[model samples]
Structure formats: structure tokens, C-alpha cells
Target: AVVSFTGVAVAVVSFTSIGVAVVSFSDGSVTVVSFSGVPVAVSFSRISVVAVSFNDIAVVVVSFASIGVAVVSFSDGSV
Candidate 1:
């Protein structure tokens, strides 16, 4: 696992053949997971709740999950 902790604001985690996780320290939390340069998922975190979504079609929001493994909603809507 290649972890780059830039600072107290940004953190990046990348693993070959796996997905990447980016954490934002800002009040508004945003997460992005990509595959082959395509953004497949996103998480809009509001406090203790993180809203997972799929492709831009949802831009798409319609699921509830957590930091660990989850049946996350694919941006492509392949939940």
C-alpha cells in the first residue's frame, strides 16, 4: 500500500490493481474512487453520515454505507 499523508488536510492511499481513497480534512467531506481513469464512485460525507453514489448520472446518490466494505453504489449505477 502506498500511502502519502501530505499533511493534516489531505491524505492519499493507492494500491496497484485496487482503487484509490482520498480524504479531505475540510468541513465538507468528499471521497472519490476511480478505475482506469474513470470515476466510478463518490462519497459525500456529512458528519457521521456518508452518502455513497455512482456515475455522474446519479452524479448519482441512492445508498447508505460506511468507511469499511460496503455495497457501495457504483457511479455507473451498477449497485
Candidate 2:
């Protein structure tokens, strides 16, 4: 996951093959996670809340609050 933010404020999280998350704002919060597997990328810009969860062969991205972004990618031997 990849998160990029450039502004008054910024936040970023990366989980390698797991995922990435980025947030930016007066105040921002970002979260990225890869569970039981490896996720790809979760991204956010000028965001407030970013959440993600991934398991074998799955990906998820979620955003919350005013401005937020989330991305997740995962792969296990099998789904």
C-alpha cells in the first residue's frame, strides 16, 4: 500500500506487500494492515481516517472522516 500526503498535515503507513495508507489535513489519521497474508497497497491523501484489512487472496480499502483513504492487498497460497 502506498500513501502520500502534502499539505498542512500528513500521515502515511506502508505494509510492503501488505498494504499502504496515507492521510493529510489539519489533522489526519491513517491505518494499514495485512492479516494472515501479504497485502498490496492502501493509499490516502488529505484524509482523516484510513483503515484496511487483508487476508489470503483479498484486498480491502476503507476511508473515514472528512478526508480519508485506505487500500489493502493480500495473497495466500489459496483463498
Top candidate (lDDT):
2
Candidate 1, residues 1-79: lDDT per residue as tens digits?
A: 1212333223222222234334343445555544444435443442122233233222222232333322223333244
**Could you tell me every candidate's TM-score relative to the true structure?**
0.22, 0.28
Off by over 4 Å in 1: 1-8, 12-17, 37-79
Model 2: lowest-lDDT 10 consecutive positions:
70-79
Per-residue C-alpha lDDT of model 2 across residues 35-57, encoded as one tens digit per residue: 44543344444333324344323
Q: Report residue 5 deviation for candidate 2 (angstroms).
A: 1.9
* lDDT (Cα atoms) of all candidates against the true structure: 0.33, 0.39
Q: What's the true lDDT of residue 26 in model 1?
A: 41
TM-score, predicted candidate 2 vs. hidden true structure: 0.28
Candidate 1, overall lDDT? 0.33
Using alpha carbons, what is the TM-score of model 1? 0.22
